[model samples]
Target chain A: MTRFMDVHHGMEGITADQLAQAHQADLAIEHEENVHFEAAWADPESGTVYCLSEAPSAEAVQRIHERAGHKPDEVHPVPLQV
Target chain B: MTRFMDVHHGMEGITADQLAQAHQADLAIEHEENVHFEAAWADPESGTVYCLSEAPSAEAVQRIHERAGHKPDEVHPVPLQV
Candidate 1:
């Protein structure tokens, strides 16, 4: 499995509860695509959110995210990490 | 303390050991600025690194990162998270 860092833009003013619900939405359906979302953080002012996940492919991550209701703007492969 | 998400670019060929050393460097001096770095992940192929930290301010996070040898390209305040 490979790790992925995905970014979502234009989500300004996202609240803590909203973010948690979205994360839960992803987690609820993650197994379908074999994606495990580790964590998520948001810069409400910038309308940007970052998600860290491990999946078989970026496509899988994107699929799970899209199905969860928030599509990522960018999905980068994280092959090496500390 | 607020969580911050910092990104570092231009480190395309970083290896696992190199990444660990960089994280260690930050951890070694993080307490000086009251910054606690939670984790770091890198996309070696794209030369991008993402760092997650809790600090008094974004500046504190930046200070520790700069002292550690890899200045952040962008440091976004993470006020909302899940």
Candidate 2:
């Protein structure tokens, strides 16, 4: 599996509850894509959210997020980690 | 405490060993700034490195990276998390 970091923009003013819900949305169906969204963090003031996950590929992560109703602006593959 | 995602560029072709060393450098001195670098991931092809940390502030993260000899190109504050 490869680690991925995805970013989403234009969610300004997102609250903690909202962020958790969005993350849970992805988690609920992530298994179908063989992806695990480990965690999500956001700068509510800037509406920028970052998600770290382990997936077969970036596309899998993207598809999961899209189906969860919060598509990412970019999905970066992070194959090398420490 | 806040979660910060910092990015570093221009280290193309970085190897796993090199990445670990770089991350260790930050970990070695993170406590001085009350920062804990949780993990680091990189894409050698893109030379993009992302550092995840819990810090008192974004500035503290930047300072730690700078002191550790891999100053970041960007440090984003992620105050809301899930």
Candidate 3:
């Protein structure tokens, strides 16, 4: 499996509760794409959401986020450790 | 291979030239650990550094950063795509 890093913007002014709700809502969905959500972080001041996920491709990561009700600002593949 | 996301602080008041120098220095090193640097971003205003890498563990990623000349604030692994 490949690894992906997704950076998201447009999260400013969001409460912790709201962020939690979004995560909860996204977690409920079953994604067909080969991706696993590993970790998620939200910077309150920057309104940026950073997530690490394992997926076949960066596009798969975007698909999962779209299914989760938010759009990613940047999604890039993490090349295998050489 | 696993994927990692690293967040770094303590970059405030640093010049862009300094940041570029650090990156160049780090990129010159060869790490024994199985890790590949995917991307890096720096915010001049906020003094935050974000990086994406593929490795077997977060420590491997940190070691690479250390070899590269910076300490990370946070490091986490991305699980395999299930």
Candidate 4:
């Protein structure tokens, strides 16, 4: 599995709890797509949401997000970690 | 310029102010390398830090981080934004 980081924008004013709820919604169906969301971070002020996950491909990550009703603005492969 | 997101780990218990200071330190030298750091997000509990920037290459991003004293575990190009 490869690590991926996806971004969601236009989420200005989103609360942490709301983001968590969305994450939970994703988690509820992620397994069907072979994706596992590991963590999420949100900057309510910037309206940006970031999610880290392990998935077979970026497409799988996007699919999971799409099903959860929040398509990512970008999905990039995390090639390194320290 | 392409947008990139980089992650730093093992930052457990770091405060938002500290991260901002580190980010400021990076900004202090970013111009020398033609990198522009746009935003940063930190999850203190998870020891995770994410930075968004515009740079010529991921290597440039790493160089900035290296100079600022914190090397990212991974730097990925942000290919899309919505």
All candidates: DockQ: 0.80, 0.81, 0.07, 0.06
Clashes of each: 1, 0, 1, 3
User: On residues B1-82, what C-alpha lDDT tens digit does candidate 2 reach at each position?
Assistant: 9889888889899899999999899889999999999988898887889888999998999999999999999888888877
Question: What residue pairs are clashing in model 2?
Answer: none
- Model 2 error, position B68 (Å): 1.2
Report lDDT (CA) for all predictions.
0.93, 0.91, 0.67, 0.82
Question: Which pairs of residues collide in model 3?
Answer: B26-B68
State each model's C-alpha RMSD to the native. 1.1, 1.4, 10.0, 11.5
Tens digits of per-residue lDDT, candidate 1, A1-82, equal: 9999999999999999999999999999999988999989999999999999999999999999998999999999978766
Compute the DockQ of candidate 3.
0.07
Runs of candidate 2 exceeding 4 Å displacement: none
Highest TM-score scorer: 1
User: Which residue runs does candidate 3 get wrong by more than 4 Å?
Assistant: A80-82, B1-82
Tens digit of lDDT per residue, candidate 2, span A1-82? 9889898989999999999999989989999999999988898877889899999999999999999999999888888888
> In model 2, what is the error at residue A54, expressed in angstroms?
1.5
User: For model 4, what is the error of residue A64's alpha carbon versus the real structure, in angstroms, after optimal superposition?
Assistant: 0.6
Q: Give every collision pair in model 4.
A: A12-A47, A81-B73, A82-B73
Candidate 3 lDDT, B1-82, residue by residue in tens: 7666677776765565676677666566634776777666665445666776778777778877887779798875533221
Q: By the lDDT metric, which is better: model 1 or model 2?
A: 1
Worst 10 residues of 3 chain A by lDDT: A73-82
Candidate structures ordered by lDDT, highest first: 1, 2, 4, 3
